[model samples]
Target chain A: MTPTITAFETSPDRGQGLARDMRVRWSLEEVRQPYEVRLVSFAAMKEPAHLARHPFGQIPTYEEGELVLFESGAIVLHIAQRHAGLLPDDANARARAVAWMFAAVNTIEPPILDLQNAKFQEGDKPWAAERMPLVLDRIRQRAGQLSERLDDADWLDGAFSAGDLMMIGVLRRLRPSGLLDEYPNLAAYVARGEARPAFKRAFDAQLAVFTSRQPAAG
Target chain B: MTPTITAFETSPDRGQGLARDMRVRWSLEEVRQPYEVRLVSFAAMKEPAHLARHPFGQIPTYEEGELVLFESGAIVLHIAQRHAGLLPDDANARARAVAWMFAAVNTIEPPILDLQNAKFQEGDKPWAAERMPLVLDRIRQRAGQLSERLDDADWLDGAFSAGDLMMIGVLRRLRPSGLLDEYPNLAAYVARGEARPAFKRAFDAQLAVFTSRQPAAG
Candidate 1:
């Protein structure tokens, strides 16, 4: 069965593929699986029906037959587990890859999210200016540790499994903050992830959603 | 062979079981697995050897034979997958359970971590007092949503899968904040988890570590 995943009717990221839905879409594309997207407005996302699908009332929920799953990491993992491409055949390597997936969101993404909260959520607050550096420093610290770990590796682990998919997805959010550019190899790593044919397809799919919603430019 | 996991020689939480190691330990206890602990001090955690095992240089790295894993969520999930007791036998149900695990860490814990950053990390900052409400409000929003979803349900989904283990573990962090108390059902939910025999064993084991390190109180 072709799974159906939800996305924003108009993503807050303006379809730059920074939204979490892109992770699910990218995973499906990587596994060469065709799926359907259900676009939801911000208002509709909070409604009871959507909330039942996702307790957090967020988008990018996966539904296949009786199964419904949320959280991009889980959804991607689900895809990876069921399909052959996104995980390794070796058991230990697979577990290590999953560890990187958790690291991307739990360890690395939290500080980056704080940067967003500081800029957009608390931008008007008096402390925002002074606190901005602290937030950036936190991101840099994680990024530095990550860069040191990445070194010259093409991917986080031996292969480009779901771990790289999720890590690159999380790091891509730092593009606007310019923190990613500070690490040359990390920047190259993100560039390499984007260059994947699966990633380009997923990127264009989400980008089309944004482009279609816009009025003619000329 | 017994797997070995790392913990803090002296956890910052001071034996409250708030450290991520508790999650792995609890999961092990639930599965009736015998494991060994290797504690690392703050200085040693950042050393090259520890960093080689865990790139982020944090406690609770799991080493079983040839496999080495970091991130408590991944470690617990690894334990869950290998043992029958932690994950539901049904495939779809297992996937849903994993979704809750991600929700607990990614969606719920980030705000809680932000509160920590605001208080302890920036507690001395000029705007610390004023900025706390915003931090608390973000946590409240997620907690409220979670409470509504949980309602009177004993667990996040069904049965006591790894999902509940992780969600309960994450919610336990809110104890000091008094945030968990605001949601009576959620508090009860956490209490139910703590009352489990497995949870007690894990809690006591970690608590023993703290007490052993302390000089006799006068």
Candidate 2:
């Protein structure tokens, strides 16, 4: 079944591929699944319609017939479970991969989101300076742990699964801060994720959204 | 296989059932699955052995034979997938339930955790008073969105699947702030989860850990 996924009509990230939809796109690309995109504007996102699809009214809601799914982590997992490449064939390995998926969003991503808030959400506030380091510290602690676990491994686990897809997605958001560089192996790890042809295709597809929207040269 | 899980030696919430382990315990109880718990000290959690089980050095890591999994969301999902009662028989419904799991942690809990940081982690800072409203606003925005989506529904999807289990666990954290009371249906929804016999047993079990640790009431 072809799933219909939502994305920002005019993304605030300016097509950095940092949007949650990029993960969904990457997951689909990894599994070689053909899907459809339905873009929604910011104003339309908060309306009852999008909210009906996603309680939080966020983009990247997946609709496949009767099932309406949100949360990029879950959407990717759903796709991975049905498809083969994103998950391992072994039962135990599959559960571990799922653990990495949750770790990426719940454990790893929260501090990253806190970092985003420190910069974008609260950058103008008087506390930005005072609060920024604290946020950065939290990110450093998590990144340090992740770097240690990853060590010299090419992927988080046996092979590239949806777990790496989610983790790299979260880590990519950290590039603007340059914190990812502090841990050389993690920086290399992110580079490895980017090197995947599937990731490049997804990145270019999302980036195209912004490039196409760019005003014509004078 | 009887799985083993981990929890705090003395939970910071004072047996409030706010720890991620509560969700795992609740899930085990719902499936009527017998399990064992191993308590970890804060110092031990950061040590190498526990880090091996959980890179994040947090509680609620699941181990059954060779399969060691961390992240309460992932653990509970693992249990639900392997057992009955916690998930729906319908494949699509199960996927939707998984979406709620991600929503509770990713979309819902981040704002809640920000509120936690504002109060517990950063309450000492000079910006505490001025910056708190921003965190609360973030929480309020998410809670308001959740409330609208729930809209008098008994569960987020249907029939109290793991989705409801996760959402309830996330919402229970808000009780101390009284924000949950603002959303009557959501508050009742949490209450209904608490009233379940399985939830009651899990709550009592975790609460017992704290009670057992307390010094004699002198």
Candidate 3:
């Protein structure tokens, strides 16, 4: 059965592929798993039906029969486990790869998300200007540490796993700030991820959604 | 062989188990695994040796023989995977459990971490007072959704899995502000987590670290 996942009918990022669903799509593409999307409007997402799949009322929520799941990291991990290419064969390597995945979402992404709050969400607040720099600095700190670790390595661990997929998604959130350019290596890392065939498929798919949303200018 | 993890020589949370390492420790206790703690001073955490294991220079890195991993969620997941009780036998249920693990760190923990920044790191900033409500509101939003979904469920899924262990850790961060009290269900949920014998053991272990740090009044 082709698994179905939920995505934002109108993403806040408007097809940048920065939405969490993009991560799920990329994972499915990586695994060569055919899947379908159920687009949920913002209002529909907050309703009880969607909330059952994702208590937080967010996307993307994965469903295959009775098995329903939410959270991109979890969904990606599930795909990686079921499929072969995304996880390592060695138990230790597999464990380390999963660790990096967690690091991407938990450690590195928080500050970047804070930047989101400081920028778009709270941009008009009286404190926005003063608070944003501090938030960006925090993000930079995380990026700098990550850049240092990446140093010359292509992937975070031995191989390109779900860890890299999640990391790329998290770091891409910083593109709007242009702060990603400050770390050339990190920027290149994100570029490498986007260049992946699977990532390209996911990106183009999301962009198509945005293109459809745009009304004819004539 | 028992896995060894790192902790703080002196925690910024003053031994409240609010530090990242506490999560790892709690998970270890939950799975009934015996582990060793290798404490590192804040200064040492920035050194190359520590950074090699954990690129971000943070606490609670896991090392079991040749297998070394960072990120508390990763470490906890590793422990859960190796143990019998923390995961489910069914493939789909296991996937759902892992999703909760990601939700705990990615979705639920971000705003709660922001509260830490507002209260501890950025408390002196001019806008700290004004900005706190917005941060709290974000956390409340997540908490509200989580409470609604958790309405009378013994745990997130059928059995108590690593997901609950991670979620309780995230929710415990809100105890200081008493924001969790606003959600009776979540409050009871956290209490239920705390009441676990393993959780009590983990809490006492972490509290001991705090009590040991008490200043000499003389």
Tens-place lDDT per residue, model 1, B5-99, is 99999868888999999999999999999999999999999999999999998989999999999999999999999989888889999999999
Every candidate's lDDT: 0.95, 0.92, 0.89
Candidate 3 lDDT, B133-218, residue by residue in tens: 89999998999889888999889998999899899988988888989999998999999988988888888887877677788778
On DockQ, the stronger of 1 and 2 is 1
Best by DockQ: 1
TM-scores, all candidates, are 0.99, 0.98, 0.97
* Residue range A8-123, candidate 2, lDDT tens digits: 88968888889999999999999888888888999999998898898888879999898889999999999999888999999999999999999999988999999988888899
Worst 10 residues of 3 chain B by lDDT: B11-20
Clashes of each: 0, 0, 0
Which candidate would rank higher by TM-score, 2 or 3? 2
What lDDT tens digits, residue by residue, belong to model 2 across residues B104-173? 9998899899889889889999999999888888888998888888889888888899999999999999
Residue B70, model 3, lDDT: 91
lDDT of 3: 0.89
User: What's the residue-level lDDT of A127 in candidate 2?
Assistant: 85
How would the docking of model 3 be graded?
high
TM-score result, candidate 2: 0.98
TM-score of chain A of 1: 0.99
